[model samples]
Target: MDRKIFRLAIPNIISNITVPLIGLANIGIAGHLDSAKYIGAMSLGVTIFNMIYWNFSFLRMSTSGFTSQALGARNLTEATSVLLRSVIVSVSLGVLIILLQYPIGQFAFRFILSGEEIKGYVEAYFRICVWGAPAVLTMYAFNGWFLGMQNAKTPMFIAIFNNILNIGLNFTFVFGLGMDIEGIALGTLLSQIITLAVTVTVWSLKYGRLKKYLRYADLWNKVALRSFFKVNADVFVRTFLLTIVTGFFTFASSSMGDTLLAVNALLMEFFMLFSYFMDGFAYAGEALTGKFVGAGDRKNLKAMIRRLFFWGFLVNLVAVIAYSFFPGELISLLTDKAEVIRVAKSYTFWTVLIPITGFAAFLWDGVFIGATLSKEMRNTMIFASMMFFACYFIAVPLLGNNGLWLSFILYLGMRAFVQTVIARKRLKLI
Candidate 1:
C-alpha cells in the first residue's frame, strides 16, 4: 500500500512541484523588475487565470475519478469513453472561453483588480494568455485521464518538459529579448500549446490501443453522460466557490496597497508550495481510492485512507518546520526587492499554519473525488467558503492582514474538520 501510494505520489510531487516553480519563475521575473507594480500586475494576471482555469479543473478531477473507476472495474470501453467525453467537453469549453475572452478580461480588470498602472501590464498579459485556453483545458483532460489510468509518470514527464520549456522561454522573452510582462504571457501560451501537442503524441504512442474499445454510442449513452455531467457539475460548483475564496484573497490584498499586494502574493507562494506537496499525496489518494471503490474493495479503501492521512501528516510536519524556520530564505528566492521581502517577513508566521490546517482538506478532497462523492465535496467547500467570508468580515476590522490570515487559517481548518467527519460517516456506507 505504501509502495503504491509513493509510486503515484513521488512522480506527482515532482510534477506538482514544477507547477509552482512556473509560478515562482513568473513572479521571480516580475519581482526583479523596477517597480512593485510589475509584481502586482503579474500576480493579478495569475489570479485571473486561476479564477478561469480553476473552475474548469473539474475536467481533470472528474475524468480521473471516472477513468480510475472504469479501469478498476475492468471496463476498458467505459474508460475509453471517459477520455473521449472529457476531451470533447474540455475543448468545447476552451473555445467558449476564447470567444468570451473580451468580456472575461474586462470583468476581471474592472472588478477584480485595482490600480491603474498595473492594469495595462495585466491586460497585455491576459490578452496573450487567454488564447491558450483550448490547449490548457485539453491538457487538463489528458492529464486527468492519464492519472486515472494509473500512469502518473506520463503526466510527470509532460509537466517536467513543460516546465523546463516554459521557464526557458520566459527568461528568453523577458530578459533575453527585452519584452515586458507580455513576454511572460507569451512564454506561457506557447508552452501550453506545445505541451498539449506532446500530450497527444504521447497518448497516441502509448494508449492508442484503447481507442479500439471506444464506441460512438457509449460516448453519449444517456446514463453514462448523465453520471459524467452530474459529477463534473458538482465539482464545478465546488471549484467555483474555491476560486471565490482565493480570488477574493488576492482582491482584498490589492485593496490593501501595492506593497501589501506584493507581500501577500509572495507569501501565498509558500501556501502554493505546500499545497503542491500535499496534492501529490492527494492525487495518489484519488487514483487508489477510485480503484478500490470501483473494485468494491472496502478493506483497501479504508487502509488507503488511513495511510494517506499518515503521509499527509508527515508532509504537513515538514512544511510547518520549513516554513517556520526558513521563511525569509524562501521569500528571498522569489524576489530581491528589499521592501517586499521586509514586508513579507511580517506575515511569514501565517504560512506555518497552512499545511497544518490544510493537509487533511487536500487529502480528503482526493479521496472524495476518487469515490465520486461530489455532493459531499461540494457541500464542504460551500460551508468553508461561507465561514471564510464571515471570519474575514468579522476579523479583518480588528486584525487587518493578520485578520485575513486568521480567517484563511480558519477556512482551511473548517474544511478539513467537516470533511473528516463526513468521510467517517460516508465511507462506511461505501
Candidate 2:
C-alpha cells in the first residue's frame, strides 16, 4: 500500500511543484518590464484564467475518478467511453469560451478594477490566450485519464516540459524579441497546443490498442453520460464555491491596500506550495480509492484513506517546519521589496497553521472524488464556504488581516470537519 501510494504521489508532487513555478516565472518575466502596470495586468490576466480553469477542473477530477474505477472493474470499453466523453465536453466548452470571450473579458476586467493602461495590456493578453482554451481543456482530460490509468510519470514529464517551454518562450519573446505582454500570452498558447499534441500522441503509443473496445455509441451511453454530468456538476459547484473563497481573499486584500495585497499574495504562494505536496497524496487517494470502490474492496478503501491522511499529515508537518524555521530565507526569495518582505514576515505564521488545518480537506476531497460521492463533497464545500464568509465578516472587522487568515484557516478546518462527518455517515453505502 505504501509503495503504491508513493508511486503515484511522488511524481504528482514533483509535477505539481512545477505548476506554481510556472506562475512564479510569469511573475519573474513581468517584474522585468518597465512599469508595475505590466505586472498588475499580467496578474489580472492570469487570475481570470485561474478562475476559468479552476472551475473546469472538474473535467480532470471526474475523468480521474471515473477512469480509475472503470479500470479497476476491468471495463476497457467503459474507460474508453470515459475518455471520449470528457474530451468532447472539454472541446465543446472550450469553443463556448471562445464565443463568449468578448463578454468574459469585459466582465473580468470590470471586477478586477485596473488602470486603463493595465487594462489594455490585460485585454491584449486575454484575446490571445483565449485561443488556447481547447488545448488547455483537452490537456486536462488527458492528464486526468493518465492519472486514472496510474501513469503519473507521464503527466509529470509533460508538465515539466510544458512549463520549461513556456518559460523559455516567454523569455525569448519578451526580452530577446521585445514582444512584451503579448509575447507571454502567445508563448502560453503555443506551448499548450504542443503539450496537447504530445499527450494525444503518447496516449496513442500506449493505450491506442484500446480503441478496439471504443464504441461510438458509448459516447452517449444514457446511463454513463448521466452519471458523468451528475458527478461533474456536483464537482463543478464544489470547485466554484472553493474558488470564491480565494477570489474573495484577493479582492478583500486589494481593498486593504496594494501593500497588503502584495503581502497576502506572497503568503498565498506558501499555501500553493503546501498544496502541491499535499495534493500528490490526494491524487493517490483518488486513484486508489476509486480502484477499491470498483473492486468492492471496502477494507482496502478504508485502509487507503487512513494511510493517505497519515502521510498527508506528515508531509504538511514538513511544510510547517520549513515555514516556521526558514521564514526569512523564504520571504527574501519572493521579493526584494523591503515593505512587502516585512509585511509577509508578519503573516508567515499563517503558513504553519494552514497545512495542518487544510491537509484533511485536501486528502478527503480525493477520497470522496474517487468514490464518486460528489453530493457529499458538494455539500461540505458549500457549508465550508459559508463558514468562510461568516468568519471573514465577523473576524476581519475586529482582527484585520490576521482575522482574514483566521477565517481562511477556519474555512479549511470546516471542510475537513464536514467531510469527515459525511464520510463516516456514508462509509457503508459504497
Please tell me which predicted candidate would have the highest lDDT against the true structure. Answer: 1
lDDT of 2 by residue, 1-430 (tens): 8898999999999999998887777766775576545655666677778888889999999999999999999998999889999999999999999999999888877766444676788789999999999999988999989888888999999999999999898999899999999999999999999988988898899889999999988778899989999999999999999878887786676566656766776777788878877899999999998889988999888888888888997998789899899988886765666766777788888888988788889998888888899999999999999999999999999999999999999999999888888888897788
Write candidate 1's Cα lDDT for 1-430 as tens digits. 9999999999999999999999999999998887779998998999999999999999999999999999999999999999999999999999999999999999999864467889899999999999999999999899999999888999999999999999999999999999989999999999999999989999999999888899999889999999999999999999999999998999898888889999999999998988998899999999999999999999999998899899899989989999999998999999998988998999998999999899999999999999999999999999999999999999999999999999999999999999999999999999
For candidate 2, the per-residue lDDT at 131 reads: 96
Provide TM-scores for the models: 0.99, 0.96
Backbone clashes in model 1, listed as residue pairs: none
Span of 10 residues, lowest total lDDT, candidate 2: 31-40
Off by over 4 Å in 2: 35-39
For candidate 1, the per-residue lDDT at 333 reads 95
